[model samples]
Target: MKYLRKLVIGATCLVSMAASAQWQWTDKDGRKVYSDRAPPSDILDKNILKRPAGRVNPLVTNEASLNAASPVAAASSPHGSASAPKLSGVDKELAEKKKKAEEAEVAKRKAEEERVAKSKIENCARAKQAKTNFDSGIRIARTNEKGEREIMDDATRSAEAKRIQFIIDSDCK
Candidate 1:
């Protein structure tokens, strides 16, 4: 009974294995193709590449092995030799707009930097001129906020000179 059971089990295994034949061939487009059914008689002899045993197809097995051998190819072709994703019309337009916006932002920032630099240079020049006038003892007068003409005293002039000097020191650098 034991020997008979072993024989039956081995025959069943052989029959299951025979039922899972796979045929591989190159299609008219030159791409490798895999199928469970046999190719047509006209193209079978010329295009047939592999007749792999068991259930796993040769095309899939070869692709897996190829991917494992070269990781770069696998990264680029996740679904085997299919082409990369193409950008649609809307995506292309969005990409272009994003690039233009980035350029505009950079230009605006540069223009702002230039304007600030020019303002600092003008401030430094005015501060230096004011300090020179105070040093020469030139009597500087100004109309007050109340519309009264007021002459600066010596102490006031000295304080103004010190303030202008501070401005020059801060902006000239």
Candidate 2:
């Protein structure tokens, strides 16, 4: 009976020591958390003493620990897939920005094309005006030439020739 009492006392002391060493903390989400180390100073008021969850016997199943030790190895094994899924974070943003830039460039090119078309139209109008002025000048010179040839008298012809020469010098030149 004395040996059994001593064993019970030893077991109680070991349990008390284990309970005293663990520090407890509560996260911002109000979830209870316990660790071997003390929590940060910001969460001092939320700390509370509580019993831990049931402990798993490592001898029975160490598969969880084994997978945690090398997660990459487990993923690459038979359980892994042929390829991982694609993520769309920064690449998606860059693609959208590139599309916007291309659209802006296309708009700018269209505006430039409109400006060029307007300039071509104005140049064509100016060329047409120049051609009309040239044709009018030729008609006036031909009329003066015909008037001089129709004059039979030499003095009248000479006077008309002088007038035609003056008209040509003033208007045609």
Candidate 3:
């Protein structure tokens, strides 16, 4: 039981040590940076606010050369001051992709409308032909539910003609 308790205590201590291994520093941009590893080599040791246990401070002792203390000053000029991070507008490639997607959507909608219009035109032509068949007084045969060939009588012909005429009225324009 004592050995088990000792093992648990040792494990807890190890976990706590690992948790304290994080690095905390303030970047030139005034942003507080936190990471598991050390900051970039360009970052001066003075900028580091916190370091893991047993880590040596590399703060430059020589006051004679300010330039030797900070290499970041040189890199800072060509790229704007790191104190203010540049905010960029929307990416050009992303904007183009969005534009293409919108155009594709418009084209898809146009194609769908054209398909529906073609279907309506075909329906109108078929309805007009049916109307002509009924007006000509020719006998028309249809398949009944019993699978038998049945001749359309006057009443049936009139009803079918009315239905066809309704299709023509709705679609012919």
Candidate 3 local lDDT, 75-96, one digit each (tens): 4432434665575877889999
Instruction: Give the CA lDDT, 0 to 100, for residue 149 in model 1.
Output: 93
Candidate 1 residue pairs in backbone clash? none
Full-model lDDT for every candidate: 0.78, 0.59, 0.80
> What tens-digit string does per-residue lDDT give for candidate 2 at 1-173?
99999999999998877876776656778887877765676764424443244332233334555467587744543324356654545687789999999999999999999997777666656555544544454322233454653313546545545655554544442
Clashes of each: 0, 0, 0
lDDT (tens digit, per residue) of candidate 1 on 1-173: 99999999999988767655667788878888777787777664556776657433333455666578677756555356557665454777788999999999999999999999999999999998888888887789989999999999988888888899899999999
Model 3 lDDT, residue 142, Cα: 100
In lDDT terms, which candidate is top?
Answer: 3
By TM-score, who's the top model here?
3
Candidates sorted by TM-score, best first: 3, 1, 2
Runs of candidate 2 with Cα error greater than 4 angstroms are 1-90, 138-173
Better model by lDDT: candidate 2 vs candidate 3: 3
Give the Å error, residue 32, model 1.
37
Q: Give me the displacement of residue 106 in model 1, in angstroms.
A: 0.6
Error of 3 at 123 (Å): 0.9
